[model samples]
Target: MAPPAPARRPYHHGDLRRAILTAALDVVAADGPGAISLRDLARRAGVSHAAPAHHFKDRAGLLTAIAAEGYSLLADALAEVPAGTPDSLRELGVQYVRFALAHPAHFEVMHRPELLHRDDLEFVAARSLAWHRLRRGVESRAAAGRGPDLEQAVLAAWSLAHGYATLRLSGNIPGEGDPAEAFRALARLTFGEPGD
Candidate 1:
């Protein structure tokens, strides 16, 4: 009879959590979130198949962490520009698109609520922070009667930016040129010149 295969060693050193997350992001970027597998991620991260469970209880847990991280990153990107100005709003949209493209893996998972633990506290807080940043730009417009209702303005801005990013990412935008430039052009068309 043949001998049994040797057992794999457990990952006990370094940041296994970060390593698994990085591997998961790579897989998501290459094949979308549905293609993610804990076994595959562990293999890619050079850990035992059970190692990912130490950090993420399951696939949903892993995705939840990714979504939270994505929102936090988006919040940081949006916060760079000063809020409560027309120019700042435009810049925020540009930043949103940039973040989407720059982190396609995280972007993909972040928007798919069904694939994540939607009630996760970290995810909720991070998402709320991103929304707060995005909403700040519209508050001034609504207060000054320069824009539509506050919620409507926020939704409109979000729709435009998210739609553009989704289209661009899916190759439906029909351009190999600069995406941010295209976004600015579209923004100009939709909202007219900044001072107009």
Candidate 2:
């Protein structure tokens, strides 16, 4: 008879939550959000089948946490651009697309509210922070009379950048040049010269 496999260790209490989230992201990156399950995350993290449930009660909870984290990271990325510079909007667009490219799994989950706890407080706050950052960039341009209509400018900038990022993520935008460069070119064409 063959020997039985060794037992797996319980997840360490200090790192279990992070481990599960990381495992979930890996699974999402590999097979999309629909494939995620608490048991599978626990298995990937080498924890008890119930471990993920302790941190996230269900799949929606887990996805909500991921979306919150994604929005927070996006806010931080946009904050890196100087707030009122002429190039800020262009740079912000590039960063937005870069963030999507860097975190495709999170990006996919972040926009799909039906798969997450969209009413969750943390998720709502994080999403607002990210939206505020993008809106602030557009508002600054409007303040300078570069774009006369604040709401329209915000919509245009956001729609263009988000559309570009989504297209790139879906493998519809092809090129060997850097994605950021492509965004910059498109931004120039759509918004006119960077410092105009």
Candidate 3:
């Protein structure tokens, strides 16, 4: 009879899977998705070429994992800042940018629909939750008497934040002043806050 399957040896230090993911993220941040390769990631991770494949079946799987993690993280960030009225949506918008800046690797895959597992229940749940939070925040702002049309207000808020994040990530916006502050200004304009 064949021996029983061996138990997983507890890894005391750096886990190979996480190390590969870390290296993969570094690659994505430095060169974007098109430039990332499994062998390169494995080499950078200091693991066998097969190691990454063990964790992620292929490039798509790796990217999907990154997207899932990004969604989960964004959801957490949205949850961190309370869904208050007026400035809450604005604050969440800034936090969204912050999340991308902080996790550029994750950000690289988060919004790429092609790379993500949109049909997967877990991915769908995470994405939906983050969006729901944003929508709820918009509703709260409207409740606080700070809007015109609900759909318009939410769409405007989404566009401002999403566009700002995309621009910042793509280097379309040069460094001079604060990106968040710029985003806040846009949010105010979009929300029609005060005399604009």
lDDT of 1 by residue, 1-196 (tens): 9999899995475998998888889989988999989998888888888989988999999999999999999999999989767677778899999999999999999999999999999999999999999888768666766677888889998999999999988989886889888999988888666665
lDDT of 3 by residue, 1-196 (tens): 9999999995443677777777778888878877768898888876677778887788877787778778889889888777664568888888888887788788878778887556776677888888887787788877767676889888877878878888887789985698788888887767666322
Give the lDDT of residue 168 in candidate 2: 89
Write the candidate numbers in order of decreasing lDDT: 2, 1, 3
Q: After superposition on all CA atoms, what RMSD does each candidate show versus the true structure?
A: 4.8, 4.4, 5.4
Clashing pairs in 2: none
- Stretches of candidate 3 above 4 Å error? 1-14, 194-196
Candidate 3, position 77, lDDT: 89
Error of 2 at 51 (Å): 1.5
List lDDT for all candidates, in order. Answer: 0.89, 0.89, 0.78
Q: Write the per-residue lDDT of candidate 2 for residues 85-189, one digit (tens) a residue.
A: 888888899889999999998899998999998889999999999999998888888888888588888889988989999998888988568999899999999
TM-score of each prediction: 0.91, 0.91, 0.82
